[model samples]
Target: MKHGRALTITITLLITVLFAVSAGCTGPVQQPSASPAVTAPAADGSSLVFTDQEFAFELRRTIGASYAGEADIGECLATASRIQEGDFESWYTEWNRTADAFRAAGDGSLAAGHRVSAMEAYYRAATYYRTAEFFLHGNPADPRIVETWSKSRDAFRDAIALDVVPYEIVAIPYENTTLPGYFYTVDDSGISRPLLIVQTGFDGCQEELHPYAMEGIRRGYNVLTFEGPGQGEVIRVQHIPFRADWENVIAPVVDYAAGRPDVDEDRIALWGISLGGYLAPRGAAYEPRITALVADGGTYDVGQNLLQNLQEGGGAPANLTEDDLQEWLQTDPAEFNDAILGAMAHDTGTRWLNENGMFVFSAASPAEFWAKWMEFSLAGIAEEIRCPTLVCAGAADHFDPDGVQAQALYDHLTCERDLMVFSDDYGAGSHCQLGAFAQSFAAKFDWLDDRMGMSG
Candidate 1:
């Protein structure tokens, strides 16, 4: 399969992503209001479709990359057609098969001396492999997690090698070891340019940020994307869990970028996606060297929101605070955990969020996970930020449906700030605008360009 392979797609269903649910919360897992009920269509339909909202959203995520060759429209539709909604095994099997097919296609294209075709095929393979591994984190011990992730990384590396622009897989020195990153430059002209540093939030890899980096590179910026503790290779290979003090992570990354001759140290910008919406802002609060910060859908207080969700849903009492939550857990952790576990049993998104949180946060159980989650707040720190910041939100954000988190973060800012909320009318209202890359990139880079005085 190749790019632009007879593709016509649309977000026919309204799907919403979920935030973690607190133990006391009681409600059906929140999702977007569905359109009129209809059977999921065949692959050759006007668009690849899914009746399951999560399935539909994720499938559209891959298909959206068709413009850049990270995904092929025909292949995504064909693979998605065979997978059963909410069936992890089926999802994994179909995507894995497609990945292997693309990988083989790339190898054959390379042998035929078709570098462009090889690059496109490898890109598709990498994305498919990543998609295959998406739901496996629920079982932390699953061997397929590492194997599929490795294939994705390897395929991405191979694809980047064939790019016309310069790309480097870098290992930046951290505490005791090195953090993996990919650096892309507009050119090797030995001229320093503004740099954009990016990291994905929980459950995303550095390789998946390739299209984001390409956006910067095309707009006369050098891009450096890395995975910190609890993310990408750091968590998978080094066994490092996430730390709330993100400045410790961002500072070292800044040091590395500042030392590079090709990076303009004065114009370094940081972007955090999804959960990173919280992480990047926390980093900027303490790291004064950062020139600008972008939180793609701001997250103010994760634990608070989770608990508040419970409160609103009648799971917990009114005005529940962190201290109250901790006291409840300490009083009878087993009982508290049972409530959370029961809730997780009903919601796939909630289960994955907590399970993945436990693994990445190094919490022993649900109670412990929520305890640690409380520390990821920007309560007193937001006002400390010195750099201009951009806080984005989806009008119908699955994780922040009310848009309160982004508004809170914006309100707390004492520095120069702007809030951009994407509306669903443009198909850019999903989490981080997953299915609308062009709109998301344009809004983000345009803001950064103006902030850095690089706007044309």
Candidate 2:
């Protein structure tokens, strides 16, 4: 089966290359939006605190629900009020301060014998710590970045130790090392139970997966949330660079889960969020043991996005063929680096992308990083997915707006497939349905339950 899938992918790639050269055309790139100011409020009553709307939405979604409402909100508002637009230092300082306060509160609570309060406070502190480290990618070796992340991990460990359900911190052996993860189980029934493997996207960590894992737990499923290469402690501590071949990562993880006595190997499912949309499907294509797959905001060709951004920035030609594009990417790196730096100087989004991309991809220059990102795609491999698959996207997801990638992947899938587009009418039309987690989870777990033979 693997050999057949490989052959299919090779043929598909050949045909795609032929089509690309014959067509001699590429889609026009949309113009880049103006650098908007991160102000307190707009006339519409929306807070313009974060330069990125998606970031703002995600922050709001997690704060009250995942963190302490009063302290986190107050800290957030105060920070936003003073944050200089696109200033990573300012952002880190405020969030880090808030995290410190939360950690102190958790310690006090625990000392007072308020276990539940301590657990909640510790969880909130961990999230705050993660938030602080989000934009500090300019220097991967920065001591503060490592310190903050360590604090986050410690807080999460403390929280889970006091959790109602059993939460086990695990170290799944990979190629030369191990990946960190948390296993959430309702009980030690000794009977095998359905399992869900949760993979976070570009900026997400294992700690942030608690909400999603809890949802799966309530549905009687054991959940494992792990951070692979280029994510969380794996990237920070072990310095494992990101790779496009996610099958290598998932296969090892699946091996670990299959060996566990509590996991029902036949009912194992994989769920990927944000950028994991692309990673999960790519893994499912090669790792055929997975029974079901869910991509929360699907992606088909990651290169298309990079090309679009490049074209919008007037760095690439609209009609550039694949061969021509590849040659162009190999050109003088210094010039490309300068262009990226200039763009980052004015655009907050561009700045974040440049810094984060270089760190995760371990590329010396922006051009190389972009070139590497182009490798992560499901164009030819989507058809190899044999398991029941669910592709989800928000109607207004700026990351994959119009659900183009999800739609494309769904159309190409050879197995039983489902695509659910959360709409703005229900306040779910944001990236990852951030403001509508319940609706998104309902759609995901419902589809998963039916496919996994679980009755609600």
Q: Give the best candidate by lDDT.
A: 1
> Tens-digit lDDT track for model 1 on 1-456?
111111101100111123542100011111132111111222312234676555676787788777677997889999998998778789999999999999999999999999999999999999999999887776778899889999999999899899887988899999999999988999988689999999998778988898889888888999999999999888888889998899899989999999999999989999998888888988999888899998887888876665555555555556557666655544435655665677566655566677888878777787787677778788899899889888877654556766677778878888888777666655666667777787788777888888887898
Task: Report the CA-based lDDT of candidate 2 relative to the real structure.
Answer: 0.71
Candidate 1 regions off by >4 Å?
Answer: 1-48, 330-332
- Model 2 residue pairs with clashes: none
Model 2 bad stretches (over 4 Å) = 1-48, 51-58, 64-75, 308-319
Model 1 residue 375 lDDT score? 80
Please give the clash total of every predicted structure, in order: 1, 0
The clash number for model 1 is: 1
Name the TM-score of candidate 1: 0.88
- Cα misplacement distance, residue 17 of candidate 1 (Å): 9.6
Model 2, 1-456: lDDT tens digits are: 112111122221121111010000011111122011111212111245665552465455555353222235555666566656567787788778888888899999999999999988888788778878888888877898789989998998898888788878899999989999999897767668999999987777877788888888889899999999888888888888789899999999999999999999989999998888888888999997899998876777766654554455454556754445444555534555665677677655566766787888777776677677777778789899999888776555555645667677777788888666666555566667664666667767887888888866
